[model samples]
Target: MKKLFRKILKYGLYTLLALFISLNLFVILSGRFYLYKGIANTYLVGESGPTIYDLDVFAYSTLEKGQGEDLILAQNYNKQKLSAADRAFMESMETKAFLVFKGDSLIHEEYWDTHDKSTVSNSFSVAKTVVALLISIAVEEGKITSIDEPVATYIPEFKNGGREIITIRHLLSMSSGLDWEESGKNPLSDNAESYYGSDLYGLVTRQKLITQPGETFNYQSGNSQLLGFILEKATGKSVTKYAEEKLWKKIGASHDAYWSLDKEGGAEKAFCCMYATARDYARIGQLILNKGKHKGEQIFPMWFYHEMISPSALNTADGIKNSRYGLHIWTYMAKSGQVNYCRGIKGQYIITVPGEDLLIVRLGSEREANITLDPARKGDKNYIESVRNKVGHASCLFHYLRMARTLTK
Candidate 1:
């Protein structure tokens, strides 16, 4: 009886060991561990993915220097006069950096938690706007014939996948009808695959169509990846190379920037992963305010710049109520006028308020949702209720805009 019991126990232990080995081998061989590693590092383990503020931290080609001067800060401007309540509010948001520019002079600049002027953090989806800017440069340089041209014109493999109908404009406006389940919780979703996988082209190209192109507003990171592929093909240069030559080099950037790639010497992960300083991001806002001309040179066409910030007829036709999206940029209707901005998840903003001649940049680690803010006041009850229902990030955006208005005031 004792011998029989020992045999049973031995077989059970052997089976458990086999399962463990098999799982580890599968993770290593399939390369799906990249996704888990990324998630673990960024979300679970609380390690920020990459930093390249002061110097290039990733494999990158250089942006040649243009004969332009670094942006100057105001000498007499109020630099440290935030009320205690306001300072508490900003601190509660886990803000890393906050910058305000009135006209061409930086007014207020502050950083928290060891983040200085030279600290670099991931821009998250704000990089999408950078890609949009690059697309405009491509069009202006005649690398791309027109935004209305079908994407398949550059990416021939997409011609037969019912993706032929997708256009450069569709991708820019994020109306591409690709089948991407953009769930942060689902590792198998397209967002995770593009974020962590090595083969950006293969992952994006395999997606099937779900809706008619240019019909409605659908936000998908894969759309940006597809746009990156098109940009690469159209210019015969990687997105980073094109950006360096056309935009970054001309902008008088204060420091070298980094865009994370899928792997070493692989395509850039264009949907996200641009690491730049807060001041440099402010330069992008200034460039947009100047109508794409930087330092007496036309970096991107003025018409394309206008189209990037202007709300589209398609957005209106689709009955997108209270929407602010426009050609990969976000818009806010202030009483002074409309404000165009680029935003990233977890509270990164490059806001351009042309009406006030203002640019506000905020970068942070963790973002506070409206629901997580102070107890709902009587006036903010509806907003609180909406946040409770997970409607959107309206409250956080409103928070930033309110803070920016103080600068103008």
Candidate 2:
């Protein structure tokens, strides 16, 4: 017994040591040590995709500078009353990046420790909003006829099974009724395996529908992936290319954005894995805020813009209560007014408040409690819902603006 115990203890120590060495090697090889240098240089040259850094430049170039812009430079609010603890909380959040703009001018910008204006933080599901934007542009350009059209009209393979009934509108609202498990930590779950698996698109598309299309509002990443496939089929070009020609270039994005391709490279994962600086992401929010217009150009049909942000048909008062989803964006009722946001897993957000002419972008590493809830007690089948309520990207920015409003009053 003593010999066995000794052997087990020795092996455990060896395993722990090996894990430490492997992690350090991964950090080094992945260029995490040189992340800041690489990101700053790369993003400035327009390499990173869909991030706050990119949006900052877009906002500054477009909006008129004012007292809010000065607050951005001060790194502390002069007019707004923010407690020391609140400021510290914002700074301490892991790898956080944020930017606020009012009618094209930057009012506030922050990048926490080890984070800078140029870091290409992952937008996660916030990429879905970009996908929606592209789809809208495609429709405006006559590449796509209407949202009511069956997805099978573009992707013929979807004609069979429940997919035939699915529409672009269904996919946008996450009401396609696809049986997707989006829990990230569960290895057996579809979303978790897809993220780490070799064939993400395949895994997602293979899923069968659990409910009839547009009958229920189930958040599913597979819906976004399917949109990418459809977009590619309709345009005969990659989603990234379409975005560059119709949206990014037209919007005057200062940085190049990147979308992660699947193993087959036939489709970009429109659900997640877009990389851009903070400012660039804000540009997207601003575009939506402006009803898909840049300068004098109508980037997308104004009707399509209204539909994308309008409440979905599938959502119920009890189902979403305080929050409503439209297309790929999340809508919230703020203290000041109604707000809509494009949110991503691990706390990435791009918020647009049309009433206030406000746009806010936030990107960050996974927050401990933001993504998932604690595991249920053993044998308790009722899974405890996550405590992290989805907060709109506009929430913080609105708070600051409200403060500014009060001060002026």
Count clashing residue pairs per candidate: 0, 19
- List model 1 lDDT by residue over 1-409, tens digit each: 9999999999999999998798678777986776565555455655554222312433434444456457787884655467787789889878889888888888888889889988777888888999998988888888899999898898877898788888989888877878877764476677767776678888888888888887777778888888888899999998888888888878988777778787778998788778788888888888988888877888888898888887654543223342456788976655558888887767788888887888889898556552243343535766544443222344666666677668657
Task: Return the top candidate by lDDT.
Answer: 1
Off by over 4 Å in 1: 1-33, 39-68, 315-322, 368-393
> Which lDDT values do the candidates have, in the order given?
0.76, 0.66
Candidate 2, 1-409: lDDT as tens digits: 9999999999999999998798668657863443333335445577532333333221111111111111123333333443576566555544377676667776666677777765666678888988888888788778888877798898676787778898999998889887887764443466544443445556666777677888766778888888887788788888778877777777766666666554444456677777776877877887888888877789877988888777676643233332457888887654567778887766687877788877777777543342223334323434422222343233343443443344223
The alpha-carbon lDDT assigned to residue 356 of candidate 2 equals: 80
Candidate 2 Cα misplacement greater than 4 A, ranges: 1-5, 9-82, 264-266, 315-323, 366-409
